[model samples]
Target: MYELKTKENDSSVIEFIENVDSPKKREDAYKLLDIFTETTGCQAKMWGPSIIGFGSYHYKYESGHEGDAPLVGFSPRKAKISLYFATGDTKREELLKDFGKHTTGKACVYINKVADIDVDVLKALIHQSVAFLRETYPNQ
Candidate 1:
């Protein structure tokens, strides 16, 4: 069996943000916290040591692998901030077009700072991700 490393924990989201090495990143983390919470209507929770996640869902693939993951989250890393959203959501790509400057990986959207992106687009992404996950994994 494979273990999921980024399980949610009872860690302090505020403390984690406070410890960010860069003051600018720390401030942006706070800004993101507000945006995600308001957009998803879910309180922020710490996932693993670094991810500040809002809302959660349990998903199991056909291969029998199952785990709980946040509907949306972000981590303020040294190089760039990572935004975690639902994978396979087509609407995500559409919104990203107007999301200002950002880079995307398989399931993450990385940005340099909050000021570099449109806050409205960020909120839309969070909402769309949550909706997609709830629809995809209704059992959870």
Candidate 2:
């Protein structure tokens, strides 16, 4: 099995975002990063090569696999921004209804542009996701 990397470096995260080719995309990345950090009250850092993740939660399943992951986070992908929020039992449509124009796949909420979505709605989703993760994975 492939193990998820747990270590994070904020400087590397910034450098990665800065290297993005589009100025608008770069700006949007930082905007999303700021919102996630502010709403979750958790520091943000890069996960792997692309994801800007927030906070950390450790979890172990019944099958005895255990690992740590970001409690809430998002990645600015080429086609759309992916917000990772599904800890299961998410009120996804309720959140997305307020999020303006966007799409979704599995647990990720995909946004084509930051301007396409209401910033306040995005912040609320981040907060809600973090709260859900905390509730679901508490002490686990």
Candidate 3:
């Protein structure tokens, strides 16, 4: 009996972006909104308080843990922008080679700004993530 902390909510994605402490970060958040929206063909939704997510899927692990998560998302954080994509996609590492300047964590790609990355590669990452999630968890 576990509950997911980052469930999708009816929060305003724009309001969240508008409140980003840094004006530059706020601007980049808008740019990312457009990129993720057009690339994923999905409207942006607020996941939790800060994450601007596009599209979603429900996944259940073999250990019986299950939750719904966005196919792709990003957050304009105080330190750096966090990009969320499918975790197990084999192409993830390959795509990161052309993703421009960024660092990777288990589930997020961290970038200093949109200018630091190739927009084309970002779009490809978004598409790949959505497709991977759809294939990995079709029923949800």
The estimated TM-scores of all candidates read 0.98, 0.88, 0.98
Expressed as tens digits, the lDDT of each residue in 1-140 for candidate 2 is 85766445565778888888788888999998888888988878777778788888887889988887787788777877888885575575687888899887877888888899999888878777778778888884
Q: How many backbone clashes can be found in candidate 3?
A: 0
Candidate 1 lDDT tens digits, 108-129: 9999999999998898888889
Note the Cα lDDT for every prediction shown.
Answer: 0.93, 0.80, 0.92
Show the colliding residue pairs in model 1: none
Q: Is candidate 1 or candidate 2 better by lDDT?
A: 1
Arrange candidates by lDDT, descending: 1, 3, 2
Cα lDDT, model 1, residue 76: 99
Tens digits of per-residue lDDT for model 3, 60-110: 899989889999999999999999999888998899999999999888999
In terms of lDDT, model 2 sits at 0.80
State the TM-score for model 1: 0.98
- Model 2 misplacement above 4 A: 5-11
